[model samples]
Target: MPTLLETYIENRFRVQPNHANNNETLHGGTLMKWLDEVGAMSAMRFAGETCVTARVNELDFKRPIGIGDTAVVESYVYDAGRTSVHVALRAWREEPRTGEREETTASSFTFVAVDSEGKPTPVPELEVGGAEGERLRDRALSRDR
Candidate 1:
């Protein structure tokens, strides 16, 4: 079994001109893509199989990340079904020099584990036993409200 913490994944992307809109802020599509990638990685880590995105819950952008800022994306598996893994994802904008960071986005995703034949496959039960695991799971669940 995989613990919730064991499925956590964090990645950083430097926002450049190509990733920005005319306003020079990170594009929504770009951010969504990053979120999906990170979410899938977390799901795969928990399932130990290839995971394909099944659904993306509501995503809202709270702030804009300007070009030259670092966009940090984090994701972890919070719950799982027989073949579906639920992941919570969040993104923050950070000033590289100052190390100041503020959350910019949040969303949840569902991924289905797949076999080599691309059919849905069962996954092991998630272990959310320890204090840290429970805390993380609670945090993600709270975001639902």
Candidate 2:
């Protein structure tokens, strides 16, 4: 098994016109698409298999991501259950040229492990070592309550 950090990579994508609403800001649908995709990737790392969204606790679009801004979505495995994984997802917007960044949206999503045939599959026990791991695990667990 690989260290959690080894399996983690921040995903960055631009907020294209097609992803925007008539007002030119990123649509809610677009934000969720990115969140779900990144969250699934995080869960797959811990599950070591394909995963599907089981629930999305909350999706807060605190700020708007406008056109010409790059949307940076960061996701990482934070906690796990017998057959489920929790992921912390954050979206940020940065000016394409100057690199000014600000958080635009945030969400936490849960995913369940699935076998090749798409049935529920058991996942490995989470081994949260070190201070950072402990912190992330605590945060993820807190979200359940």
Candidate 3:
């Protein structure tokens, strides 16, 4: 069983010349690609099998990550079903010089586990073993609001 912290994965991608848009901010499509990749990895870690995007609940780009900044993405499993896992994901912009970071986007995505044959398979029950875990699960559930 992977703990909440163990399920967490953090990665950073430097925005380069080609990673930007005409306006010099990270492109929406590029960000979505990163989100999908990280979200699937988090779900696969929790499910112990390969996973694919089942759905994207919501994606809110509140701000922009500039071209020269590093895009720091983090993901973790917050909810699960018999074959699906809900991952909470966030991306932040980090200024290399000042070491400042701000969240630029957030999203919740669902992934379904698949077997070696690429068929949907059952996933382990998401374990919320204590108060913190319960709180995270509750937070995930409250996203419906």
Q: Show pairs that collide, candidate 1.
A: none
- Candidate 1's displacement at residue 95, Å, is 0.1
lDDT of 2 by residue, 10-74 (tens): 88788889889999999989889888998898888778899999999788788999987899888
Model 2 per-residue lDDT at 18:
89
Ranking by lDDT: 1, 3, 2
For candidate 3, the lDDT comes to: 0.87
Off by over 4 Å in 1: none
lDDT tens digits by residue: candidate 3, 8-116: 7899999997999999999999999999998888898899999999898999998999989999998889877888888988899999888799989988999999999
Error of 2 at 28 (Å): 1.1
Each candidate structure's count of clashing pairs: 0, 0, 0
Better of 1 and 3 by lDDT: 1
Encode model 1's per-residue lDDT on 1-145: one tens digit a residue: 9899999899999999999999999999999999999999999999999999999876989999999999999999999999999999999999999989999998999999999999999999999979988988999889877
Whole-model lDDT for model 2 versus the true structure?
A: 0.82
**Per-prediction TM-score to the true structure, in the order listed:** 0.97, 0.89, 0.92
Order the numbered candidates by TM-score, best leading.
Answer: 1, 3, 2
Residue 117 alpha-carbon offset, candidate 3, angstroms: 1.2
